[model samples]
Target: MRTVVYLVIGVFFGIVLFKSEAASWFRIYEMFQFGSFHMYGIIGSAVGLGIVIVQFIKRYKVRSFFGDKIVILSKEKSFYRYMIGGIIFGLGWALAGACPGPMFVLLGAGYLPIVIVIIASILGTFLYGLFRDKLPH
Candidate 1:
């Protein structure tokens, strides 16, 4: 049942993204180019919904979907780290013409060059995991 729900959610998101013209690198690039608010609007809506949902969970003292208790971790407030991470992410996105999620889709669509980006992303993730504890907060 959980797996089915996951599959359904994944399919739903895939459909939404496909329909929104979000999977196109050119479209996404255009959003960044022309001061277009389309992408920003989509992201703002998502963030707004997420904030409301999280507030509802907090207000209701809700635990989890399966009745498990929730464990909330404190976020590190490090402006420098965030700036550095954003710069790296943006550079990769601009260079590859695909962010992480879209990279997989592009690869599946038979763009073989995305394999290198995927590998590099994986390595970066692994390295981050390895050194995260040592990084300054």
Candidate 2:
């Protein structure tokens, strides 16, 4: 039941992403080219929708899909750690030109280069897990 709902939502978004050409590395790269507005528009729409949904959740105390209140973790308030993590994330994104979600899509689209990004992302995640408790904030 819950799995079916998840699968359906996933498949729906997968189809939308595929049909919109959002899963293509070339399309994503072209978006950074200043001349193309397609990618920018897609991203803008996503951001706008996310903002609206977040506002609704904040205002209404909406139950999440899992029937629980969505937890926003803010216990870790160390600015330095967050800054370092953000810098690392930005550097990886800039170098790879694809985020984790898009990297999988790129791989499916026959972009072999994304394998490096996937490997690095996995390694980063493993390293973070190894040190998260020990790391300050």
Alpha-carbon lDDT, every model = 0.80, 0.79
Ten residues in a row with the worst lDDT in model 1? 14-23
Worst 10 residues of 2 by lDDT: 70-79
Per-candidate TM-scores read: 0.82, 0.72
lDDT of 1 by residue, 1-137 (tens): 77897788776776677567666678778776866777778778989998898788777877876687766556879899999899999888877777887776766567798899999999999999999999887
Clashing pairs in 2: none
Alpha-carbon lDDT of model 2: 0.79
Off by over 4 Å in 2: 73-83, 109-113, 133-137
* lDDT (10s digit) by residue, model 2, range 25-120: 577678756757887899899999988988888788889778989755446477899899888886776678876767776776677978888998
For every model in order, what is the number of clashing pairs? Answer: 0, 0
Clashing pairs in 1: none
